[model samples]
Target chain A: DAGVTQSPTHLIKTRGQQVTLRCSPKSGHDTVSWYQQALGQGPQFIFQYYEEEERQRGNFPDRFSGHQFPNYSSELNVNALLLGDSALYLCASSLGKIVGGELFFGEGSRLTVL
Target chain B: AQKVTQAQTEISVVEKEDVTLDCVYETRDTTYYLFWYKQPPSGELVFLIRRNSFDEQNEISGRYSWNFQKSTSSFNFTITASQVVDSAVYFCALSMKTSYDKVIFGPGTSLSVIP
Candidate 1:
């Protein structure tokens, strides 16, 4: 049983550039959620997707968006990225209708915006 | 607005010394969930435990234990006989059982266990 997997373990981009980070949820899981963890801080909720539909979102701006495919994999897209956007992007997966299930997290994709 | 607060910013203790991490939460919903996660230097959030609003039973798993108090809206975690490898940043999170699926995380407490 494979755990959650994320792509581009490390990446660098310039401000105002658009970036896309991908994630594959754990097996037997149907929900994928995205979180952002800045240095020295805990992970913050971004949004969640279930059944290929966005179920909920956090306090992030319109520049941050995500998509979930039928296979339960997810993609986090950030537009007009700011320097503050440079952080670790973590993807978590759970196996239930509610978000209270045990969340299995990926190693996270570290984005460094210049 | 839901919020989780970890009062201790950082802690250092010698190996074999016991340590406790405090977590206080704020939520209007009676039905909610509390969680603790450990983030080691390797940079991954590892789930520790989860406690629902109704369950006040303190849990003990190996050298780890959690105390959930709905009356005070607090859930504390304790590690017994800590080891050097136990050093990590601990986070507390809360999520309501309602339509809101977002889990609010705290500022995390960094624990350093020295040998």
Candidate 2:
């Protein structure tokens, strides 16, 4: 089965602009989560979408939002991007809403905000 | 609030040597899960292992082993007879058993196995 897939492996954006990163979860998975990993750092939780609704969110600001489609695909949008927004955006998928299931991750989309 | 701490920022060892990466976590939830993910130079977060709160029994797979000590709130990983391919940024993460709970990750430990 194909694993989680993310679009636009790398992209460049300027400050105050908006960008959307897409993700297709692993086959047979329903829940999708987004994470941000800065240089030399670990992945930080952004939010999670389940059943086409946002189920959980991290400490990120309102500028960071996401949507989940019926097909279990996801999109992460960043508005008014700041220089610090530059990072690797990772998309993970799990079988259910519970936390114990193994999470399959995508290679991630690298975003550079100039 | 849930948090994870990986104390070692970076560690280097000769190819044949072994290395242990430490991870400490803090969480209020009585039932939770702990995880270890390896991020290689290719930049993919590969899931290594997962452990639940009640099941503290240590786990071993191939050359890798994990020690989970609830008494110390630590879940440490050790690589035996490490190789150059083991070089990666290892992250320790925690997630609550509650539905929709987000996973919290540590700063990660970078391991380098030099030949």
Best by lDDT: 2
Task: Give the runs in model 1 whose Cα sits over 4 Å from its true position.
Answer: none
The per-residue C-alpha lDDT of model 1 at residue B90 equals: 92
Would you estimate the TM-scores of all the predictions? 0.97, 0.97
Candidate 1 CAPRI level: medium
Model 1 misses residue A77 by how many Å? 0.5
Candidate 2 chain B weakest ten by summed lDDT: B95-104
Candidate 2 lDDT tens digits, B1-115: 6789999999999998989999999988899999999999878899999999999999999999999999999999999999999999999999887643588889999999999
Deviation from native of the Cα of residue A63 in model 2, angstroms: 0.9
lDDT of each: 0.92, 0.93
True contacts kept of 2: 0.77
- Distance from true position, residue A71, model 2, in Å? 0.6
